[model samples]
Target: MSRKTVEFVFASAVTTNGTFTVSYPTGYTKGDFSRGVMHRLIALQSTFESPKGITCSFGASSVTVTYKGTTTIPAGSKGIFGFDIAGPDTFRETDWKKQNHIINRPAILRFVNFGSPSTVSTTALISAATGTEMPATAASITYTYATQGGSSPIDGANTDGKLYPARNIVTTVTHASSVPTMTVTHTFLDVNGNQAVETHTTSGGGTSNTITGSKAAAQLISTKIANASTTQTTTGATLNVGFGSKLGFDIPILDSTQIAMEIHDGAMQGVWRGNEILPFALGANEVGTGGVLRRIPAPINGRIVSAYAAVEVANNANNAGTIAISIEQTNSNGSGVTVAGCELAFAASATIGTVVSGSTAEGAATAEVSTGNQICVVATAGFSTNAQFSGSIVMRPTYTVRGTLAVADITTVPSGTSGDIYGTYTPAFTLDGSKQVGLLVWTPEPNSNGTPQYTV
Candidate 1:
């Protein structure tokens, strides 16, 4: 809403240290104003005028002026007095926030003479102010919502305040619309909050800088960078990579042996009681050997590197026989086939705590296992009832551990300077692929000489 005021200067000179009055022949009225003003006035006048330093006041029907200036009022001296169109005594505008006006046109104002030319008379005729139009008025009125795309225009079909003082800007605005904000679930923004990413640098500069994120003493969406931060030594240095690089697994192993041991329990699987042998669940003594000793699920895609089984207790000394156990796996065709070079053998005299490696004499097909495959620990033909033994298998990963990724999901909060500041998260799987592939890629920011060091 807007409030347009029309005012001008009083032509005739004003009196010094004297009084005059202005009257509204027609009765005046009052209403609410945008500035929170609710005065019982159809017209307003300045209590003090410049140059003449005159003072004025309003009565129920007239405005009285008292001049106290040391000099005579200039001939074309200007004075401002605002008067709104007459309206009902009580404000009728329901949206009380807007400035209201009765209508627009010229106002008739009669100024009483000022200062007495005759010193003895004490008061006499002086000048009067000019006239102007008080065209209809306005102050802005609407509700807006600043959303994802942009701030929608003033709601409702009313308008953008095009009254007497047409303008697009509003001093006070309140957003009360129930419109929800559109969501931008995923966006390609940079880690530094800049536009498209730049080229990568192979090294770091020599300055120290802290890249802070929305944090509470925890998390990795940020890191400390440097204009000249040392990366320590090449062979052994602590590296602060902002996010994961590419496809890889968080297997609890970091080496070939460790990975092999991860696929199966490294401990012996068998039952024993105080050095006494019992009937084996694996048919260790009953079947004599040459049958399935145990079966386990192949939980990962890897190559079996070693397989071993051992006797937990010696067979009865009365009967003599030989026993051997080897690792085997069910292929996609469901056929139980023996793995190459993976076996553990025992002689009739074999005692407690005897361990033997699987033969490992098979082709590559039997050595590799896919997820969902079943592992079978088969034994060579031999027999005994007290032959108790334990077994285990080990396999190494067939894929490289990327351990990193290229980009992370970024979220930003505006900061006045360089650009918007952002924090990020690395997704648990490949970015857009449905497959649960663990992969991430990372590169130094363009124009950034950031160096990533190894943490030893």
Candidate 2:
């Protein structure tokens, strides 16, 4: 389909810094233009000055412009912004047909600012002689972070080692057919090279399907961590989603504190998934009880890849003290292995209410600990007066995957003759015992008698 150009002209006066909304022409929806296309068109046709700190974003039927600076346009000033809309092509078509197939696309502009009152006028220019309408039929899937548990406070005095809470990832599927069954697959590795796979299916006579993380699955994950040997050392997992015989997409997962992934076909058809790292803390006062230690349990059977320590101290008047901090790990039998250490000193009469922080990397001779080993932070203080302090140690573990896990599947045909399948495979580990998780999503081609696979 050919691209259509639409222009919008607004004559408005702004007396204050705020946001303004300009609605698109009638018949055109937000998803009609992809983010990339909108950005390109805006960069080409936008007359709004960036020096004014003006930034704009496109929505279903309108554009919201925000002025970050204190600049104001004189009354009756004209602001022109325009963009070209061409619906997704054959391969890119998400929820709608080609751009040429859409008719009655309207350009409507409206002023939306609670700031000073302003008057504005708008006009739309469409380059099409006639518009065409096309039928829309597309299925979609979405994912969200459901809930997470198993978190411990980071206060400095907790000695009991606690396992990280089990996490849940949820997804929803919407289809046009009744009694649609969707299959989801999960593949993850423990600190050991052991890979586990879980699959679940749900179907009913409804338009929407929701799959929640099962308690059994959570238990399985926890069990894997507990069973990890001292030698196992892997981090993260590989994830993929499939739609029976239709298509599938691979989602990315990595060693980040928090990550979010979104899959979009056009605008309306897509999925979103994300994960977050829980935080830990501890606090204490007085030199005697002021020493604090924190431990991070191994998620899977994996060796420590790296370790670091951070400590903060607050001292009162007449307090002369020295604080020592170290990162240590234990063997399976609970023997201690010191990985790194640092020391902080406060002088008497140096200053009242002085705060100090010390951070250090692991010693050069630091060694990696095995799975089931406890990695900890230990602190000691010698003081003549009162002092308060707290600290935490973080250790990253690495592991390998023994085998592949098929996480998701969809069957377009009743006999399951035509469908999509998604799986994850672990590659070889690096010298540090770390491996990359692979996501695979593919569908069998019908003409090839289901022999040829098409990857997405």
Candidate 3:
């Protein structure tokens, strides 16, 4: 016979101790079914259960196995042939308590080839844990190849490999979609309760700095920056950063929607009288658009019965002078406060704000204040002389203001001038329902400077 004809004849024969052929049905899952077939046939072809009781049947187009019990071969299935026979079995633990323990009963299998079977232990192959036994159109199957001695033949070919045919398994579970939201704020002030200025190193030696006060403190809290003073820098002494002084304060953020702050008012009280007194012009340049000082809108409405303003004056023979500062506000035209449709006049002695009649070394001395009058800060001592004073005052109508400024959300508070100082969260999630609630909070950060650069 010809070699080709001999090869054909050899391939057509089914060996009881060596090989077998697999024939998938025409309507079987259209793609790969190797693993599916293998898993199904493994149990049917098992000899460990009954040894000789297990047997295999070969057909002209496909193969089947018969055992003590009945079995079925779907459109796509697998088969294995070997001289050694083994199958799944059950083991028990000596002690009842250890029966369910993994160490007590473990699955085991043993097989040996009697003859020089080239496909016994040598060509033995098994699929990995078949996650499930579904008739996937395109399933994957894995098998192993070994030498006649049952040892791996390829260098690393024996290593584990995975296969995912054109199919997948299905599973069901539950997941969640919820998150969180927060906000922050900060403030800066001078030892004298005035806005402090800081020099910047980036303004081409310019003396531009952030103004120190509740405004600066509010900025810090809102931005969630660790330290604002450290962020200030300078290059040359051509100019001092007098835009704002170096001042720091803490404003407590109570809740997502509210915050409270206890500000440090500079020195002596009642220095600033009612609108009756004209506030020192400082100069026409300081007056701004209106005759009003630039200020953050008050959070609520109240009166400044009195205040404390403090200052330190350096002795300078060439520039010896004194100046004082004070403030007063009112809802004179019913723009701020009105009770029971009755318009209250600021001219009324009852309409009181704040008065600072005290003085410090650098500036103003005794400045009397009254209702419907301007609060004044008069220099009682010399500016060039060593002078410093501290004082407090009485407030009327309970100083209460409303905060109307809109705040944004925040993620992380910036630190050490390196990380993000502030962030706003959106599409805020809630712990309660499918929808979410939006709000904000200020995260806390430690101080960088132990004390103020200039004391009040």
Candidate 4:
């Protein structure tokens, strides 16, 4: 790289605030100067008092330096200064190319002495400068699921029949820059409440961060009911067992079974339950007794979102009955109040091994299902024969937990004097040959011989 040095004597020595302009070569503009180059120029120091108190500002095609009132320059003497200017090719190339070529133009130092305006001292300063390159902005974050080691259906015991356990899930956050903070949350259905929740938080300055957490387990309830030989009219059977312990389960049963299921919060207080009745005649309303199916621990406060019951009827010569499944909440008096229900009627010729299902949305009214509730199932024979059926009851509840992550704000650089120059300089002397000051802009090349290349 080649540098152009030009010097001009002051018309008159400056004793008060004044301004001087340095115009760039033709076809060059301020946009060509990189922020790194500008910063280097601003750090230069001069022995002469005039350039000491001077502040520089950039323009489209020139630089204007404003001097304070306290600055002074000797008459008919030499003053030296050095700084980097942009070259035509500086803006056209990449940062790597610019750094390797030292593309900045040579420095032009002009000193205007008092008493000798026409006798200006013009000197071109040149040098090679290099420094570490810092990132200009932060990078965005990337997220993904980490490998989870475990078995499905997380069923702790075989007695619970295929009940699924909570899932242990992990999520990783990554970035090219640094990640200061991160938060992770897990949500799932709860048998005791509307939902179950878990959360995790982490903080550090690095390229990556990981958050580990797990979802709540789902609940399942399974049982078998035999047909009633006598024409049952009321909920007469009693199976004392805990229900809604963790989450809820589905009801799977055979067809032609006259049964009803009910849930309560111990104390015989009904929480929710359903029933199925067999018809004696072709189109008769099947009626049956409601009894306690299971007594379960009270669930956390939450609303029921969904409830369903499925019945599979076996092929029988005489099979004419109706199946109904329902979910209800108990009143303060322990009475059952239906929130949602599903019913299906079976014909005499209904195909053997046929399946019928019913479902209702429980989340609409935000129905509350308290803890320690009792669930019951009852069966009724429509006519002389009892319906042979099997099924399960499944319910899903939701829980919520929240978390947040915030990054610190960046501070701004204040405006003022940069600092004293780092290199050496000689005082201006009139008797010596037009004294010269050279400044060359250089940047170290990582691939080269590790020497800074001078840019003129």
Instruction: Give the winner by TM-score.
Output: 1
In candidate 2, how many Å is residue 111 off? Answer: 45
Candidate 3: global Cα-lDDT?
0.23
265-368, model 1: which lDDT tens digit per residue?
Answer: 12211112121111224534444544665566666666676766667767665544433322344343333766666645566777777777653433466677
Measured with C-alpha atoms, the lDDT of residue 91 in candidate 3 is 43
Question: Can you rank all candidates by TM-score, best first?
Answer: 1, 2, 4, 3
- lDDT per residue for candidate 3 within 1-456, as digits (tens), equals 000000111233232333334453433321222111111224333521112223334354443433333333332333333211111112444444543312222322211111111111111112111123111122221112222112221112112211111000011111122110111111223222332222112112222222111122211100111112333221111111111211112222212232222111221211222311122222222211222222222222233333343332222344333233343334232222111111111111211132224322321222222344333333322232233333333333222212122121111111211111111111211112222222222222211121122111
Tell me each candidate's TM-score: 0.28, 0.24, 0.15, 0.22
Structural RMSD, model 3: 37.1
Model 2: worst 10 consecutive residues (lDDT sum)? 121-130
Ranking by lDDT: 2, 1, 4, 3
lDDT of 2 by residue, 110-171 (tens): 21111211111010000111111101122212221111112211111111111112122233
lDDT of 4 by residue, 307-406 (tens): 3333333324564555443223452224243334434555656553655555556454423454434333333244223334444444443332111111
Single out the weakest 10-residue window by summed lDDT for candidate 4: 123-132
Cα RMSD to native, each candidate? 36.6, 26.6, 37.1, 36.6
Report model 3's TM-score to 2 decimal places. Answer: 0.15
